[model samples]
Each structure stands twice: as structure tokens, then as C-alpha cells.
Target: MDRTTDTTALPLIPRAALFGNPRRAGAQISPDGGTIAFLAPRNGVMNLFVAPRGRIDAARPLTDERRRGIPGYAWAHDGRHLLVVKDNDGDENFHLHAVDRETGAMRDLTPHGPIQASIVKLSPRHPGEAVVSHNARDPQWPDLYRIEIATGRSTMIAENPGLAGFDVDEDFALRLAARLEGDGSQTVLRPDGAGGWAPFMRFAPEDAMTSGVLGLFTADGRATLMLSSAGRDTAALFRLDLETGEATMLAEDARADIGEIIVRLHENTPLAYGVNYERNRYVALDPAIQPDLDALDAAGIGDWGIQSRSEDDRFWIVGAASDTAPGVAWLYDRKTRALEKLYDTRPDLADAPLAPMRPVVIAARDGLSLVSYLTLPADGGSAPRPLVLLVHGGPWARDSFGFNPYHQWLANRGYAVLSVNFRASTGFGKAFLNAGDREWGRAMDDDLLDAVDWAIGQGIADPSRIAIMGGSYGGYATLAAMTRNPERYACGVDIVGPSNLETLLATIPPYWEAGRSIFTRALGDPATPEGAALLRERSPVHQAARLARPLLISQGANDPRVKQAESDQMVAALKAKGIAVTYVLFPDEGHGFARPENSIAFNAITEHFLAAHLGGRAEALAAEEIGRSTAQLLEGAEILP
Candidate 1:
């Protein structure tokens, strides 16, 4: 395979401009509505910043994290403190940190190293405390605790006792838990007040993921908001009575599962819930909030989300997103029905030409509906152009309509990007998700091939110029596409993808032990001889000798999910087979590139690789660009040049 050496004079959007850290993003309002808090760069690192509600310009930094940035945070009921989650050097063992906004003091609430902490519930009734879960006691399951914000003290609320999840009410009290059974089913348990728990409901393995609790209803402790796929193809939002096991449907979509619930902070009442099939759509449940929803819809710029609301629910900090416009924040004053533009996430791309992402549905060879998003180059004529078949990571996760930086970057480089939600994608209900079970490289890969054929039939993609690229599971699919149908893609790129399913399952993080049964049911139970043979048959590493196209691979050294060994073994196999490949490794990152410099460098090399194989436009990698990041080229050194 020969690389494309011809260079075009098209304007090159700098890699840093697309992949560098956002100046400021994710703005939210305080509970009292007196101040707003958001993430912004402080000393070259992202930190918590707060400002008065009406005067966001006076925002000041509250945390001085210098290495990795805070991933997420929430305001405490008192408004003077906030809870944040951050992982060390991308190891993914997140620690909960409580910060004092007044004195800029911070304490690690869960200081146990490599133990993940997650918020189970939070309420104004417990002003300076939150129900948190920590897996320090057991790597396979987490135990619940009431963590105090003021003293960083923790009181054990509920021990894991071999349960998968603990359900809490509006008062931050644990009421129910889902326990994984030996048969891969789940038994929902309710506490009997005397410390013993009894089964309330049982879900078969097929229905476990489709049916789950949202939270206990604020109006009635005995009733809870739940999602159930029982007696239906798609999951629906329902108010379920715990005592009688009766349920009433609230909001539902024929084609997708019920998504997240939007709740009022103090009152704990649900305002609306979300559904995402092609794009995200909200179903308003509370009539009082309908007018505010209408005003946000009328803004008509992009998808709007309520970031934070005042206690009285009069003022809302909203975040708007569009395919062309990555992000923009607004202050929506509900009383006046006005949207005041606050800031642009990427002001540099404000004027850059971006392609429109259109949603399309194509039927697979097996007649399954495949929902996909396509973004074509702005200047590329209505003819067959180079295509990048970008697959999403979660075979369990679905791709939605949104502003994706990768799609924009590839489109600007003159390639049509197609991201397909193959059969197993969520939100489409239980049947579609179930169809992906045990079909890893078979029906799943066929669906991707069918998508390419559809694009070629539509004259939107050049069949001879198509390349496959993805991360994680999508990365595994990239390897599968190249090996199973070597004549299809011109080249391929895989990031943090597992090559051998057997080793992949065996090396899963210890903390994921509780969910191993789900994986076994979804893929193959590698613990059995039959499952071992099936996994080996589907593994791309075992079929490396059939590789017919060049490949680019990237892996993070510290990735906790898809370990670096996955990439190493695949590359070793390819090397032994004398197959063409480039491998890049990041020393200071995990699952994916978290640091701005590492992200920029990875994308730069990737752009260079795509241009070499597909003849697309690329910003030539400069020496300084390569020197700035921690990315080390392990093989195929020509990818950067």
C-alpha cells in the first residue's frame, strides 16, 4: 500500500483549534440563584469557577487542580460548597471531592486509592451531605455511605450484601436494591425496616437492562418512577406502585426507550423526560414548566438543556448545542421569556464552515433498521466522495444526533463521515438491543457493511475510497471489517480496542465483577469451553494473517477498561504476519486521551494517516506539535510525516 503524497492547497484548520481544551464550558447555576458555577481554565488546567448570577464576568476560580481536570460536579444545598469527581492521571478510579467556595478549601471525601465513588442520591433535606457509594470494601460491589460536606465524614448507610444497585428516595434514603442472581437474572429487593431485605420483583436476563428504577416518587414513597419493557417492544416511563406491583404509563415512544428524567431540585418533582431516537426529544410531564420549554424550543438555535435552576424555578442556566455550532451557553430568564447569550464554548470555530449532520435510516441485509448520521464536506459536490465509516465505541451504546468534533474535523478534511447505530444500540428498545447479543462480528459487522453499500448506492461515498475507524468496540469492529472483509475498506484506525475477546473478558477491571454476568450474556461466557471457542473464532487477533489494508492504532498506557495489552497483542500478531500498521501509545492517559495536548497530537497523527490513505486534506504535523504531547510512536514512524 502506497501513501498519498500529493498535497492540496485547501485551508487547514489547525489541529489544536479542533482538539485543544475549551476556554470555558459546562456552566451551571447555584441553588439559591444568587451565583453561577462552571468549568474554565485556571493556570492552564480546568477548575471550578463561580460568579454572581447576573454578573458572570466576575467569575473566580475555586479549585486549583493542576493535572487532570474535574469531570463533573454538583452544587450543595447550602450553595457555599460543591461536590466534584476527579480521577488520578486517567486511571478512572474517581474520587469524590468536596470544595468550600468561600475559603477555596477542598478535601477528598473518598480518599481510598483506586476505589470508585459515585453519588447515589442527593436532596436539600440533607443540605451538606450526599448518599455516596464506594467500592473500597469490595472490588466487585460498592457500599453506600452518607458523606458529609463540612467534615468529610462518612457514615455507612447500606452494605453491598451482594447487590448490583441501591435505589434511594427523595429524602436520600435507600429503599430498594437490584441483586444479580446466578442465572444472570436480577432480583429487586426492598428493606423490611428491621435490616432484612426481601425480593419485590424479578427480571429475567433478557429484561434486566430494559427494566430498572429511576427513583422514588416525591409525592408517594411507595410509588417510584421506573422504566419497563414488560409486555412491550420498547421501554416506557411508568409510575410503579411498590406495594401492589402495579404500574401506570407516563411517557413512551414507539421506537425508543425512555431516557433521563428532568426533576425540580428542591421539590424532587419530575418536569419532563427525554427520548432519543434520531434526535433527542423531551416529553413535558409537568404543565407548569411547559411555557419555559416552549420558550427554549422557540429559540430555535440548537438542542437546549436546562443546566441548573434557581430554587424558585424562575431563572435557568441553559446550554445549547448544534451540529455546526459545538456549544453555546445562555441565561434563560423565565419571567421575561428571554434568552441572553452567555458564551461560546469554541469561539474560534464560530466562523469556520461546518457541515450539516443529517440523520438517515438504512435497512441491514437482515432487514434490521440501522439509524445513522452523515456529514459531508461543505464544498464537496453532489458526487461520490471519500468516506470515513466512523463506528461508536459501545456496541451497547447508540450514537445520537449532536455536535461531534470528529465528524466536523473529518468533513472539513473532505471526507463524508457516517456514524451508524448498529442493532445493539440502546434507546431502540429491548428487541433491537437483544438482537446484538452473541452477534459481535456476524450481524454487527454485516450491518456496517450494509451501511457502506447504502452510502455508495446514494452516491454519497466512493466505495473504493472508504476507510473504517472507531474507538473501543468500534475499534474492534474496525479490525473485524479489515480482516473479515479485507476488500472493503481502503484502510482502518482502531483506538483502545480489544483484539481478543477471551483476554478482553479475563482482564476486565476488578470493580466490574458485579456486571460480568451481563457481559457474559451479551457476548459469550468465556468461562465455558463452548464460549472460549466462540470468542477465539470471532477475535481479530486470531485472523491477523488476512489483513489486506494499512492500519493505524492508538492505546492509552493507563487505560483501566481496555487495557494496553489488547493493542499490544494485536500489533504483535500483525508484525509477525508482516502486515502494515502504525501504533501510537500515550503514557499519561487512560480509556481515551483526556489531556488537551495528547488529544491534539493523536488527532493530528490520525488526520495525517487518513489523508495518506484516502487522499484527504490534512494539516501537516509540525515538529513542535509532536513534541508538545506525551504520545510516543511505537511503530510505523511515517504516520506523522
Candidate 2:
């Protein structure tokens, strides 16, 4: 077995190049500022990678081959153990585990079958311990449980029937518990030492005007920041004084949806939080007062965030990215504003002189504004090229002008891709997001059509060779577009998208029990006859018989949100009608591909599918570029002529 094999003989990588996949998350900073940990897929899957603190430190893998969705882990107070959580069953039941920093000791904290738990906080005083939240007692709601690191013993700390979440402060204390009421209202209950509960803030159903009740980001002693989705107002961040019960508006935009910060490096201090508004924008927590944010901002130099920040907060890290540079590691200097390149995530893509992402604002047929990102072939835009209408998931999620892999892939293949931030998208005002409510298969799908027309109007897209692709909500839209309005898209690709809105709303996982509140507001009540009918009318499945174009569907076998049955039903119905459809399922993945092999494999399959139909280019598949699963898909697929 020669360690040196011919990588060139294969499709993607050099034999000498590192195999397996790199991590998907950014590197993390240790509380002591002496080390950093990041996600890296070493043996064909993603895991944690740690490195010593300094200008130069060789990174080492901290976590071995493990299950996915463990991004919700943190370091204990002593920073000697990494507390991790994994969802064993398909229902998203999480089990907590402890990993020792010095000896890489991996131990399960919760051993119950299909028991669901979450790591709420790491005790600052008790080195290798953490405060966990689980619904072990109640399947409907969760409470706090203190877990001992060495032993798998858990003690009941606080139990509240209405508790939805718990947060511990820097002192390892369970300071706040967010309880959800039946009426979609919320209450913040503070922990009283006497084991009593104190109400700090209460949000009523009518107070939907100020959803400041969405829970607050309570730092050790800093004021809490609430992310509110007030009516007709876009979601924004608000600062509430925990002492005075007073709230101050920190950031708001009637035209933008604001996001909040849940995690920060070192003492979990609030540093720079990110908000994807009208475009991609990051707001630091007054970097002037705290040099850490500024230093972290400059960590790798440029505007990139480093894997993590230091404890003392002298030097900060920023991750760097560009059109040509998918993700490059850099160290930025706060004092001198100097940027130093550390490593490039995808060095093999150096020759990809990709074009920058540009913003475009077009009026919906109804005169409403829609924001979109326009990516064209690098050959100086003006020419009309084939177009790919890339719909994004979370129709609630906005697409800013940035480097998106899918967008680049489509553009690189000589097709202009248009990703529209339709009305339901956040970052805009509440009205914009609300405009998308209940419009799923109707106007929302219209917005996508309108975007294609805009590309035609801009003379950038060849209307004849148009295609549409997306996952989840986007996948739903892809099917809806082909079903609701048949002649618009030449080809449709749905990835883990719901075929029926009613089924999706009803079959939601237990962990997403609270999502019903927001879903009801956005999608109406699915239990009611009227809501059921409307959802059916808007469902792609209900209109599957109307399909006239080729379709490609991909789904995760264990996806809790978008059930595999969604894809199964759609495919069955389509094939039942004698329609040609391609389907792929990854048993090891969840909602999205957590492993790089999955991504590269899916990308290769998608490219081949698109090229043969759209008459575009398909980059030669490579072994190291992905895994055997990816190559298998391309083996028999018809390549572009």
C-alpha cells in the first residue's frame, strides 16, 4: 500500500494533498488565550481542531470521527474540557459528552436512550463541569440539570414547566430561564438563590409589537440584548437593562432583519456580533472600549474572523474571504491594522478568478422592493449568458453581496446566477418579512420569476436556458415554481424541500415545538381546515401533476426538519405521472451536508446535472476533491457535450 498514489489520475486532487475534509466552522479561541479549536473533517468527516496560541501554531485535531450537529459545544471554566452534544435519534434528542483537553478524554454525560439535553453553561468555578438543560422529565419543555464531568452524574438544579431555555453567566450560575406561554408570549425568570423564581420581563400576546420577549443575550454583568420581531417591523436587536427593566434600541432597520450574538471567545464576553442586513455587516460591541473586539477583528488581518480570540483580548482574529478566495485564514492587527495571511482553506481554487458579488434592487410586479445578488461570468458582464435562478432556503434568510460557493460554482460554469432576497427575507423591515407570510407558493414564487425577468431585463441572462435550484424552502419553491407556473423553469432541483406545507408544519420535530408559534404567525394554523386547504393549495405535491420539466431531488435520510418523506412523496408522485426524476439520499447526513465529502459530492452531481441540461461546463470530478460517493454519481450521468 503505497502512501503516495496518483491524485492526477483521479478527478480532483493531487495524491500528496491532504485527504478527508476540512471543518465547516471557524477556529475557536480558548478562554486562556493559549490555544484555539476549530472544526475540521479529518477522516472523511468534520471534527474539532485545536492549535496553541501564537503567531505561529500547528493546529491539531481535538475531536475524532464523531456525529454531526455538535457545534453547540463549549469549554469548561478551566478550559480543560470541551463539552459536546450529539443528537442520537432522528427526533433530535441530544446527549451531552465531555472531552478532556490534556488527554482527549471523551466521556458521555447523559447515557439515556434518545434523551434530549443541551449544554447551557460551563461552571467558571468548577473546572470540568457544565450546567445542562434537558426535557428528561417533560417531553414538552426542558429544565436545568448540573452534570459532573468525571462521573456521568446529573443533579436537578431548576425545574419549570414553562421553561424553554436556560442561560448561565460567567460565574457558572443559571441566571436566567426563558419560559414560553401558551399564547406565544414569553417571560424571563431569574434564578433566586432560595430556589425561587423572579420575573424580570414579561411579554404578552399584544406586546407582539415589541417581541423583545424573544429572550435576551445576558452576559455576566452586561445588559441583555433582545431580538424582537415586532409587527410590521423587521426583527432588530434591543438592549434591555436587567436592573431597571428598561430597554434601549441598539440597532433596527425597517429595511433589514437583524440577528443577535449567542457566543463569543474568552469568558464568553460580548465582542463583535454579526448582522446580515441590507448587505453583510458586522457590528462590534464597542470595540473602542474593549480592545478584544478590535484585536479579534484584526486577528487574521482584513475583515475575516479568526477561529477564536485571546483571553487577555490583546489580539483579535478576523476571517478573510473574497470572490476568488472562498475562505483564507488571516491575522489582522488592531493597532497597526496590519493583515497577515495564515492559511487558505481551498488553496487548489487559486486559479478561480471569480467575479465579485454585486447587489441589485428590483421592484416586484407589485412594486415592492426585492434585494438580490447578481453573479456573472468573469468575462466582463454585459453579455447574455445562460442563467441559474438560485433560490435560498429560509426564504426568511437574506442573500447579501458576498462569496457564496453555489453562486460561484454556477458562475464558473458560465451561467449567470441570480439569488433574490424576496419579500419574506429579513434584514429588511417587518413589512418586507410580513409580505412574504402566507405567500409561499404564490407571490413568493412570483418574486423568483420576476428575478429571472430582471436578469432578462438586465441583458445578463439568456432566458431560454434558465434553471432553478435550492434546498429546503428554496427546494419547496423550486417545485412550486414548476407546479404553480409550469413554463418558467427549464429544470428544477429540490434538496430536502417540503412537498406539502401542511405535513411539514404538523410533523415538525419535538425540539422545534416552540417554532409553532412563529410558524403559526407566518404560515397560519395548520390544524384548521382553512389553513390546511391553503397549505395544500400552495404545496408542490398538490400540484405535482402539472410538472413538465426535469427535476433533481436530494435529501438527508435523518433530516428532522424537512422529512425524507417529503422528497419520497414528490418523487413517487412524479414518477407515477411518468415524469423523469433523479433522486439521491445520504443516510449519514442530516438537514444539510455536515461533511465536506457530502458537499463536494453533491456539488459534482449538481454540476453534472446542470451542465447536461443547461448546456454548461462541469469541472472534472477529483478523488481528493470529494469521496467515492460523489464520483459514483458522475460515473453514469451524461456529461455536457
- Winning model by TM-score: 1
Candidate with top lDDT is 1
C-alpha lDDT of candidate 2 relative to the true structure:
0.68
Clashing pairs in 1: none
**Clash numbers, per candidate:** 0, 36
Candidate 1 TM-score, true structure as reference: 0.97
Q: TM-score of each candidate?
A: 0.97, 0.85
The lDDT per prediction is 0.86, 0.68
Report the lDDT tens digits of candidate 1 across residue range 1-641: 33332224346666777888787898888877888888988876789999887788999999888887777799988787888988877887889988998888998999888898988887777788889999999887899999888888899988887888898876777788888776678788899888979989887777787888776565557688788888888888888787898888988899888897887655456789888888997788999778877888888869977788877777888888988888888988889999888788888887777779999999998788888999988774786888999999988898888798999899889899999999888889888988988888989999999999999999988888999999999999999889999999999999999999999999898778878887888778888898888899999999999999999999999998899999999999999988878999999999988888888888889988888889888877787777988989999997767
Clashes of 2: 36
Which window of ten consecutive residues has the lowest lDDT sum in model 2? 1-10
lDDT of 2 by residue, 443-502 (tens): 898888888898888788776678899988989989999888788777878888999888
